[model samples]
Target: MSERVVPEDSRQRRRPTKQGAVLSEGLIVETALRLIAQHGADALSVRRLGAALGADPTALYRYFRNTDALLLAVADEMIGRAQEGWTPTGDWRTDLRAMGLRIHACYQSNPRAAALAAHRTTGRPHEKRAVERILGILRSAGFPDALAVRIYHAFVDQALAFAAQDAAALALPAAAQEKEAEVWNAVYGKLSADTHPHIAATFPLLAADMRESGYPFALELMLGAVAALRPERRNS
Candidate 1:
């Protein structure tokens, strides 16, 4: 069989698929996200995407180098969604909190994709813009250059790490998730003070804590630490 070649013009404008649907990078990513959300990340193969978009599977190569490239694009789109319509309030801590929460929520909403792609570094516009905004927030808040970079690095990593962790839990099967959620009450709730004094005493707190995400509390702790490092705060 002769190897098929993509026309250069096809790259310059939106290409119509065999089923007559227009194809663009944005369309591909959006379609991929919806399919993944509905059917899980394993449903994101080029063949499936092509079928969904009514395009040749090879046509996706025009926009992405390979499956990983497409996955990165999807990941970047998640970041872009988290950033949509958000403006920094000029208060560094508040802005960071909002950014962190937005990112976590975006990932949780697409647990399968987030579980698969959260660790990927997509050097795309959305990721780059997020990095730029975070650095700018820290730098403008009186953090020294090196300090700002360090804090920005930690902040981004922390957000991604929590997103991945929470998304992993959410990605589990419904039955498995329900069983896991019950462990705190089923196991820990039975511990007696005579056998495990500390745990028994804190079981109420532990049960509440275990049922929810710890990201918000962790975010606040990080922001409080950063607050103490701000030059103005330190000098004052």
Candidate 2:
């Protein structure tokens, strides 16, 4: 049998969980996400993260200077996850739509993290790769460089903005979530037809349609407008 090699230098500085499991950046991020999901986004703190990991709070500082760094990591991980297995079909419209939906799903998957990091920058490797990939898609569609960049900005910003809004709702407390739903049914759906004829006319369909995601519908509107702008792609 061969002698076992030990990571003495690396292992020396590693932290451990209460159960003796070794701590890692990935585990910390995963635990942090769970804590955010369990508590509210506003409740994320170094102390809470340490507790979740069963390690001293200071231990996290070894990997992250502070909660903001951790948040950045979480945000990058979310984006990385979103980009996984994402192979383009070369059809700009179809591919862009798929990518938008993926981005939306990623944000909603980790609502609290999404809300916190939406306005923040994640200059990590995965984020950079994602940006390059998106720009390539727009370029491949035959959009002029400047115009492609503009559309890229609009497409990304629109997706994230809507995702953030949708995620904020998902992160609301159970009672709050229920309350919002009740408003759709008991409030908006019940408006007086005379006082609000337009809303009243659509009120019947409101509850059902309202329960579904607005991202896809809004995405198509954006794509259609973009197609119109592209003379070559207008028919496409």
Candidate 3:
């Protein structure tokens, strides 16, 4: 029977709204992400998400027990986006470097979401799949199991850590963000050569260079160190 096919407790049921919209878990998660993007991380909640989706606040509970569950879902969705376009070449170092950058870029695209993901682990299928792919890259590079695992752990942690830091900075209110720039210009730009010779020397470059991310620089340093540890390179 149709009833047997679709149980009474089935949470997959969609509810129509006055705005000619229907609510589902996917829609709820998508709207939550949009709200975070538009209004910053503080924008999310059962009520706010419901309003955005044009559904009752209780309707969201059917899909996700609470906000934490919903945030994990959002994070997993972000990981999926990060991993979607990645295709590994045969070169392990190249692939790993690219992978790091890709994840960074993915998190940057949705800063508030990244901030939330910073402290939580989804332990979900998408993240697991990404892990497998990275492990394959390291193992194929002739790294022993133990070393490969260590490198993978460090590499991922570094990328995510930097992404979160960058997202937190970006999540600052517009006035706050501008204040950082103003401080760098007003303070760092005016250091005296007699009192702060080193800073004065670098002041010209600081205006432009400091504005750019240090993630790529740090990532390359880590990757180069890992590459040198490859068995053939070590023995040679």
Candidate 4:
């Protein structure tokens, strides 16, 4: 009987070397982040990332214990990007608004990364700094320490959640996204005049505002509500 021989490349696929591993972790993470951003978190896998990196599947374990850990890292990296060059000007409202918008913009830039990081807390340095800065702004605005923390939590959580939802909606395939818009237009455009007089009357303004702005309007509304609840204003 003739002995069977495995292909050289097939054998090489089973093992990876540490040489030139400097770029391996970063490359894997970047590629995974891109894939996740484009395809959603469920689309990522160590094996797939390795294949994308042209390394052994086991090669990724050197940097990430598993996919979850790598995801956390990606989340941290995205937050870090959001916080790059951030500096507070000491005006609590302006500072907080800037911070909120910056973080929101970061998610907007990469919806996939935002979706993955949305509900997952890494407690990474950047995340900690963001929390501290937000809490500081609230406290500076005369919120009680405890209340400031609570408000900060509410603000960040809501902002991130909304960002994630927006990202997911935006990430939909073009056809599906257009279909959603068409459905909205159809439903709103065809509201019966008599049965929905109030809604019908306001439909033009609503549609105009919807076309002009979506999340920014909501973010502004949220900030206005939070500002109205400021302790200094309440005391005055």
lDDT of each: 0.87, 0.81, 0.83, 0.73
Residues 11-32, candidate 3: write the lDDT tens digits.
7646586567777767877888
The TM-score of candidate 1 is 0.92
Cα distance off (Å), candidate 3, residue 136: 1.1
Name model 2 segments beyond 4 Å from true: 1-12, 231-236
Task: Put the candidates in lDDT order, highest first.
Answer: 1, 3, 2, 4
Candidate 2 per-residue C-alpha lDDT over 1-236 given as tens digits, one digit per residue, 9 for 90 to 100:
11234343443335468968788888888887887777756445777777777888666666675667778888888888888889999888988998899999999998887888776669998789888988898888888899888998999899889889999999888899999888987888778989989899988687888887888999999999888777575345
- Top candidate by lDDT: 1
Query: What C-alpha lDDT does candidate 1 achieve relative to the native structure?
Result: 0.87
Deviation from truth (RMSD, Å), model 3: 4.6
Put down candidate 1 lDDT per residue, 134-158, tens digits, no spaces: 9898887888999999999889899
Model 4, 169-195: lDDT tens per residue? Answer: 777888997887776469987899899
TM-score for all models, in order of appearance:
0.92, 0.87, 0.90, 0.83
Of the two candidates 2 and 3, the one with more favorable lDDT, higher being better, is: 3
Q: Which of candidates 1 and 2 is the stronger one according to TM-score?
A: 1
Error of 1 at 233 (Å): 6.4
**Candidate 1: Cα lDDT at 19:** 67
**Which runs of model 4 end up more than 4 angstroms from their true locations?**
1-21, 233-236
Best by TM-score: 1
